[model samples]
Target: MLKDFRAFIARGNVLDLAVGVIIGGAFATITKSLTDDIIMPVVGALFGGFDFSSYFIRLGAIPADYKGSVDSYAQLKAAGVPLLGYGEFLTVVINFVILAFIVFLLMRSVNKVIATVEREKAAGTAEPAAEPAEVVLLREIRDELKGRGAVPPTA
Candidate 1:
């Protein structure tokens, strides 16, 4: 069983998938950083220096003057406040949309590359150039005449 498991793990697809997962995880971290640390700040600044992340509707009296920049969703929930958490949700939605678009674009390019490779492979073995049917018939006739001791006509 251990040997079988090792063999399974050593398969080409399994190895590729593992590598892809690791690369994807790293890429996700980069994208998350870009979304949170870079893009969102610019987006927030554009809307009259307003950060949507801290904008929430409170249902209970955690504090009437709660600072907009309180850290973490757990804290908000723990504060016993009936909360909308709209800003955080909006941020996450934007991040998802951006990531989705990036993935879509990447997949589009990958598909194009796969298609091109398939097309090239198909082209490689599809067919060699063929003589015209009339030319083939004329060659057969010429060969038959030669076999019959006919003199060849000079072109």
Candidate 2:
């Protein structure tokens, strides 16, 4: 059982999956940062500095002891207030869309390259190989023999 488990873990698919998961986690962090730090800020600036991060609906009443502003989503949440964080959700959704689109474009490019290589391979195999010099010489000799009526021209 242990040997079988070891073999399973040693498989190429398992290793590749592990590496992909690690890379995907790292990629997620970068995408999140890009969305949060760069894209959202630019988008906000374009929309007259409309901040989406603060957009939320209060689901519960603020405690009397809460000193922070009730309008602030972070402050309310930090004060144990229930809130519907639509803005944060929207930001995450946007990040996901961007990441997915980038991955799709990358895959499309890779697939195109693969398809081009496959077509070249297929074309190479479909075309006849150039005849060797000896084969050409033999064919010429046969043609001369046929012209002199020494041998019937074989098709």
Candidate 3:
């Protein structure tokens, strides 16, 4: 069972998947930072410095013991306030869109490469793979035998 598990882990697909997952996690962090730091700031500047993340609707009253400012979304939320954080949701949506677009572009390029290779193959322009050494050696032996008349030549 351990050997079977090792074999499964050593498979190309499994290794590829593991690498993809790690890259995906790193990519997600980059996307989040891009959305939160660059894009959102630019958008806010365009909209006269209006912060979208602070534009949530308060569904419940602030706690009596809460000392944080009522206008701050993070503070109110930390104070156990029930609020509809649509702005934060919008930021997450933007991040997802950006990530999806990048992935789409990557897939598109990969598909283009695959199509070009297939077309080259169909046109017989692609270089043929080299013959294996064993096959070449066997052919050499056959030629030597045929030259000596030990192996009959084909009609």
Checking candidate 1 for backbone clashes, the offending pairs are: none
The models' CA-based lDDT, in order, is 0.83, 0.92, 0.92
- Candidates in order, TM-scores: namely 0.66, 0.80, 0.71
Residues forming the 10-long window of minimal summed lDDT in candidate 2: 146-155
**Per TM-score, what order, best first?**
2, 3, 1
Which numbered prediction scores highest in TM-score against the true structure?
A: 2
Model 1 CA lDDT for position 4: 100
RMSD of model 2, in Å?
A: 5.6
Stronger candidate by TM-score (1 vs 3): 3
Positional deviation of 117 in candidate 3, in angstroms?
3.5
Candidate 3 structure quality by residue, lDDT tens digits, 1-155: 99999999999999999999999999899888988899889999998999888889999988889898888999999888999999989878888898899899999999999999999788897578899999999999999999999999977
Cα lDDT of candidate 3 equals: 0.92
Instruction: Per model, state how many residue pairs clash.
Output: 0, 0, 0
Error of 3 at 141 (Å): 29
lDDT of 2 by residue, 49-105 (tens): 987969999988889899998789888989999999999889888999999997999
Q: Model 2 lDDT vs. the true structure?
A: 0.92
